[model samples]
Target: MSYAGALWLAVQEDLYTGICNGTRENGDINRPKIIREESKGCLECFDDYFLSQCFHLSRPCLTFLLDFIKTRLKKNVFNPVSDSTSTESIILATLFFYAHGFLPSKITAKLGLNHTFAGEAVNTTSKILSELSSSFITFPASYNDRMGVAQGFKNISGIPNVVGVLGCFHVKVTPPPSELSLFLNTLGYPSVTVQMVSDVDGNLLSVEQCYPGGTREQYVWERSTICQEFVSFRHGQTWVIGGRGLPPGRHVLTPVERSQLKTSAARRFNITHSRVMTYNQHVFGCLKARFQCLNDLGTVQADALESVACIIKACCVLHNISKKFSVPLPREPVLEPVHPTQDVKGKEGEKSFYYMEETREDMIETCFGQIRDEEEKEANTEGWL
Candidate 1:
């Protein structure tokens, strides 16, 4: 039978049973004599069923739940509990009334109690439930530890790459700044620096939040140091650090070479009008433009921008590794042209695309130059030279 049919039959059976059990006059069960109108006792019957199912005070789970309620009450965490009238029956009655969205008068009439008692019970129970919900339903620390870094890189996708592709293309809503601040505050640091890491699939691998009470540069330095340490300990793969320059060979382009590639990519991707000026800007803009172009050209959405970000991040990790090992990079891989084609399923065929060797080289050079310029300015100001 249909669910509606079954529900109707059940309702009929309940009504029949209620009629067989005649109303009592003195025990708050009889229809009020003053009304002299036919009343169905629907509220009372609903209250009885709901209370019977939900309020089993003798059950272990109920006992545990009540214990939590009592503890919060003793802590004076709830305003309702602070105003006295803290009985188990009142708590249960309050829970029932609020759970069903009943007014105090309605609840009192249904449960055979005074309106004042019902009101007090509801107020106290609501406060307790509120506190419980707030304190109990929280994301675990491990979830933050795992997801924090991945979210940062996801944001980086909006920053363009040398190929005019959106490197971190995956749309991810990060935790609000206030929430991040609260999380940092809980770390018991005057100031914290966070280094985020992601995998080839744009999955967040780890987040290292460090205490570095200093200037912005100092914080960045400390976080980089922490990132280096984490990479060394976790991956042990030498090709995982930043700022060491791209893999060496004719195939790989240096910063200057990558700048040319960016200009070419911008033109090819119809983004020449955007006119990305700086190397950093070019790198950021190219990736963003490329993704849009790819989407337009393929007539399909490519969800691999974040994956590209991960690949770049992983290469940065290798640069860090090179610094740690004091070793030069290996030869660059041969570049292969990836052709766009529509498969039988009307989807873009899978193809291999290479990062322009010069693009990464330029990024490292730009980073180093900025660092050196800052150091030089600091030295000249201090007259140490």
Candidate 2:
């Protein structure tokens, strides 16, 4: 049987057994009564596709996530009133809110619960998950982990020693009451800029969301804690690739400009660099597609910037978890191309430019030189023939 069908059978079996309590509440007479058994039936009947659609996660992932966070939730979320709400319900409510960007009232209405309960559940769940961010989104600390990351990127485009793709995503938030300009990004929307480093499969290795939307990418990177950690990666001979506009550093490589390509090796390097960046782009696309809340969190209260940050972080944790299960996106993700910028402003920026230029050149020679030499050798052989 399919997973959903098997789950239905299990729920049916549970109904006959004494495992489920028959107690149910109908706070709203217009809404259908929800009991322990029915809730299991509803969730279990979710085939993988529908599960991913409603919750932005597959059954395997949802199951794993619940088990993973169960101990933490019990310790933190258990209370007199909350005892009635199952862990599954809390997760389902939070996932629905994240996937649909629905208000707590709407989510509770759909789940046949009161607004207070649903709102609390959503907040508590998001808070709990956000607290678990370090567990889900982690940088490769061990040598083997770093090597694995490097190998994954090397497989992508023959790029050597790349541990992650450095990128940023703009999360739309409601216009704040004060200093509104701080939240407005280049797109003229009130947003929060989230810096992230994604692996080859688009799983986030590091996440930082301390900056306002209008903050410069370079400024965020320079001040980020991960930036310091990457200096260690550089010492380990592992680096990350960033997109256009960001100045490269000892631990970061950016795509060389087309005009600056002096050889076939450089041209190929640029193409490959662009291709690798698409992985980063795909990640943002998938993230927003799965958790629509990130697309526009404008409904949030103006003063709830901390809540917004928590929600974004929780969504990122969920994104990485969904990626763990290999959950397919419900729709095609829109990928934005990397755009170049000449706004390298500062002494540090200038130094990074020159330093990474040499690094990029060395990479071009080390990684692609052999292929270029082979091409030349083939041309000579053809000429002889």
Candidate 3:
């Protein structure tokens, strides 16, 4: 049998037995007559018809998955739950959630566990997810490496030397009490400016983060580090604004001057430039646009786009893309069969038991038959050969 087919059978077997035997109300094995009959039939059916459905994995792969779970659980990063909840149950429920995006009740039926236990498990697992999100999700270091590098600009327009061009935009966030409110609050305001040294590519380099309420002088000074990094990397790159170039000189503009210049430029270009007033504005805009483009992409594509954005932002600040930074991305790992036989027993003569029942073959055939009928109806509607 194919590896995947074998793996599926093994997983079903493991789950059925693991739940029935692992949870005992009293010392005696709670083998109801119905459960025993079902299990016997299931075993026979498995041996005769689905023997090929078993899977194996390398030791390293198994270790990796276990270690990942252990690390998260040990840190108490999981969602907060009642003290009575079992960590093992939480972890299993979490795995199901991640794989299928279902709620606890749905997973309870699939795993053959009590609904209340499943709910508690999901809560605990959510804590772990929350912790992972906070600790692991980060912008790529490539962003720093590629900061201060511009792309797509080839010509100049009307202003005396441009000391810096800022990208401004507002990031709309739902008000307080929302899940994303914290990040919005961190920005201190909705609008922000992103100042980068412009390049031949018409892209801004050396991105920096800042509040929206700061004065023009404060904004420029706040971004001075990024500017300095950019300049250091590209020794001779000039800063252009409008049509003029600002020779290498420390120039700080007042709020009035910056506002007036921005207004005049917007008029001339017929493009709205008010959004480029703060660092938060710029970063949020860039991120939103990039994420939207990647929403439908596969995991690899999404990851690549995220990396590219980070690198581009970094190059804009550093004026080079060679620096290294680590970016964490979501990864899906292969799951292995969970054997209940390995679990510890509380007392002598205590043994874990599982119930597996043979589902009627006719039931399976009927389901497939229904699916075929549906497909034929759709095909007829579409007039497909």
Candidate 4:
């Protein structure tokens, strides 16, 4: 309420009370009214320190995102100055909404927006940002780029030919419409299963939103364009590494197929591959760490899975941009293994199981077998000496 309206309401309350008390007749009930001063609230709004802790970005970083929006909007729906909701404010509202996981009402109160305007700003900003997700989060384009990421994975435990790491995380939602059983996950919560691929640097390369948190990561992969392109391109000797949630395939490799590996060579390869895959853990560690909206982790905050998923996609872009600026990672505590950012198993997983068995053995022989041979030669040389 405005200052004047609140004053009038208080005065009316006093008069009504006087009449009810019978302290004054109708003539005396109406008199000049006194209004107590309104207390000051929200002393600080969107401060730099607060933005860093809240929105996970400094003022400069926020401004950069805003500027990107400005340029993109110049040719479209945005009227930076004339629009009732300034582009800058919309971006701030979106960040504030997700950063703190606050509702539109609280956003209105804290951000000082008019009632109901916060939600609009959030929706508008989210749409704008999501549309540009591809502009912000990009996958490897050239062969060199693929090799670079592969080399990064190779650095971890000397694992090679790893173009990327695959993973999934659930974005919680209000109990989805009861009709949609697919939206409910194993945890008995409504969510959207988000599948993502990150380079060894923990930068998100590709992200696809899938429904029903219970949907397996491998199923999502089989249906994803990234997987299709990967399989079709067959970039020589390059493949992404994933958890057992996905079948060992030509497009994606899992640790040296434990069930089939009967030799020491395969065992050595599996040991190293397992260690390198933990880098996926760190990537997710960094992701949910940077974007709190995705994790129910510290606090039980949620929204519509679709909206949350879109917000997450937008944040993913910012996550990439923030990396370029060297924004400090969040100080979130070490996450337990139960963190939602992990894997999924598909019903069709069985069909794809032996899909790449030959490819797997060949890769083992061509990639990891050499390592075993070198080790054996060195051990024999040492014994001879």
Candidate 5:
């Protein structure tokens, strides 16, 4: 080639390379530079409030979490050598991501971490918590435990034999390429339905399962393992209370129709039922409030559905852990679940409905029948006097 032509080609190549590496001001994307935090000393400087502000966990709870998962995190999340990121930093970064819906790049910049470690930390941390879900978020299986939960519910709501409050909530997600309709909720947005059972104190007893955003709540419950347990009478003599929409069974109770509330006793019963049912609302509110990641799962995609589910389970486990340590919920606005307008009938058939209706009648008679008799007796005495 001629020297002049070769020189021209070289000049063009240099200009292209310069453009590729140019700053954002020059109409090119500038890659963020990582500034690694090498010293463990920085961690010592953060007070409890600051730690909670960043990670949404108290110091002792954070310590407990670190101690609880440090060994596994060391093995799974961090390398022994050549990985300078401390276990605490990784956890803090992951929790920061969960507490705030920050992008990985922002997290890296804030915590002095690289993109790779930040991503791995979130994945590993969620996996670890998901694995611990069975331990942390458990439904009472034993008779004694079930009874204790029942007693707690009765004390709080004055409703007898309510072992848990059953409900479902929605979490936003980006729809996948395949089966896109499954992820779109009734409100015309992509989401996943999280079915849950919570005890009186808003602690989750079971995260029964996650379903496609568009799945019906009644369908999810009918297929839920807890509902099966109830159907089989595995948790004997204990029934959960929910909205009138749920198909009531011998082990589950729902309020009567609005027409049935004509009597004062029936009105009282429905009010009490509502009081108990709202605990499920409280559980969802506190869970989402405590871990904002459940509110914004940006890292999640359609292909990684299982990962997102795990992350949700992990947040639930963390929620229970926070409750265990008495961690106060952050001061955030709690979003209420939308109530169903129409009733949802289960596939359990009419026979099951009659069976549960009988139980509800018996409960009402036991609770309010004597009061009615007393009122009549007092009226008679007043007339005589």
Candidate 6:
């Protein structure tokens, strides 16, 4: 190579490098900067629909949740080592992973996190949310609370003293590790059962999840915390209405036999009872509708039965929080489940009226809060002036 050519080449190389690096002042070194957040491509599901679909909430609701979490929960990383991933990013990414049912592998690129980190985010977020469930999902433990729930149900259905409605549904998912056989429903699909107790407005009062697909709704409800403490009858005559499968018990009641009972009162009872019970379907429909991840029917896979249950409990907590914040659920009413056989014949329990009595309206009005347990009686007597 000629000396002149070598000089020219060196000059050109320096100029090219200078142009690429821009000007460096003082001790600063000009180099290509790493883009941490925005450098990773954004997803189309990052807009309004993303917020609603991923978080099952709007901006305001997300803001509320974020604030609550940040305030109450410790700011901790999914892993002990500090990465560029922010706490906010971890939370948002975990929510997306859950809502979309994305595997940690798929969640990595979207969140600018590594595969293991994404997996960590999912675990930590669900654990934190489940721990916070008590603050959000609660049953009526006090008399005032019971009275309010009872009144709310009564107003909606005109079935006085109605406390809440019970229902259950199957959430399809990839089979869990150990109990793959137990997760299979009669329909020959793998699923897990989620039992819910909802008030008039589709607000979840109690959520019992993690049971196998074959688990009966009645069995789940019977084993739930709410059932043991439920004062079925508040106003002597008004009682907690159960799905057809749940036979009448001390703390619970189901409608009369429809085929055997043929009377105006029976029809009226069925109609009114159905009105309140319909929300049970509405709650599940709205939940699955809002959060598509919960409705996987088969696409989204659950890591384990426990993990899925944790997510469900978190969802129930969030659902109650949304209701408390007056977040409107799905607008249209979900139709009641159809059945050709006996009660609870379908996956969704559709409550149809059977029988109660010829007339109980006047009796209900006079007996508002007449029935009382020993504890309540003592408290009532103590407060009596």
Best by TM-score: 2
Error of 5 at 319 (Å): 0.8
The lDDT per prediction is: 0.32, 0.72, 0.32, 0.64, 0.71, 0.59
Q: What residue pairs are clashing in model 2?
A: none
The candidate scoring highest on lDDT is 2
Off by over 4 Å in 2: 1-42, 45-50, 77-86, 104-106, 110-112, 232-235, 257-259, 299-304, 337-342, 347-356
Model 4 sits at a Cα RMSD from the real structure of 11.5
Residue 278 C-alpha lDDT in model 4:
70
RMSD of 2: 6.9
Where is model 2 poorest over a 10-residue stretch in terms of lDDT?
A: 11-20
Cα lDDT of model 3 by residue, 114-149, tens digit: 787775654454444433432232212243322323
Judge candidate 6 at residue 171 and give its lDDT: 79
Pairs clashing in candidate 5?
none
lDDT of 5 at 240: 85
The whole-model C-alpha lDDT of candidate 2 against the native structure comes to 0.72
Error of 2 at 320 (Å): 1.8
lDDT of 1 by residue, 1-385 (tens): 1123245335434433443354334654422222222343222233333322333112333344556566666665444344222444455555433222233343344344577766655555544554342233221124343244324322433212211111111111222344433222212322222233323222223322222212132233233533344234332211222211222222212223333544433222222212221222232222222112111111111222232233223223322222333332122212111111111111122111134344444544453345556877999989964
Q: Write the per-residue lDDT of candidate 4 for residues 1-385, one digit (tens) a residue.
A: 1113245445434543543343444464234222232332121222344456546776677777776775655546553334423545566667755655554453444344665776766766776787887887777888898888888887875666777777776666554355346656656666666788888777888888745666666678888878877766746657777777776666677765456878876887788766756766676666666665666512122333455666778777887888888888757534414333335444443455465678777667777778878999999999999
Instruction: Using TM-score as the measure, name the better of candidate 3 and candidate 4.
Output: 4
**lDDT ranking, best first:** 2, 5, 4, 6, 3, 1
| Tens digit per residue, CA lDDT, model 2, 1-385 | 1123245334424332322344333452322233355435345544455465556677888888767655567787354233434666677777877876764453455455677787777777787888999999998888898898899889878988888988878877777467678776666777777888999878898888656777778888877888877665533877788866576677778877767878888888888897888898898888887887788776444445677778888998988887777887767788843433436556443464466668778878888888988989999999999
TM-score, one value per model:
0.25, 0.81, 0.26, 0.74, 0.79, 0.67
TM-score attained by model 2: 0.81
Give the C-alpha lDDT of model 5: 0.71
Model 4 has a clash total of: 0
Q: Evaluate candidate 3 by giving its C-alpha RMSD to the native, one decimal.
A: 26.2
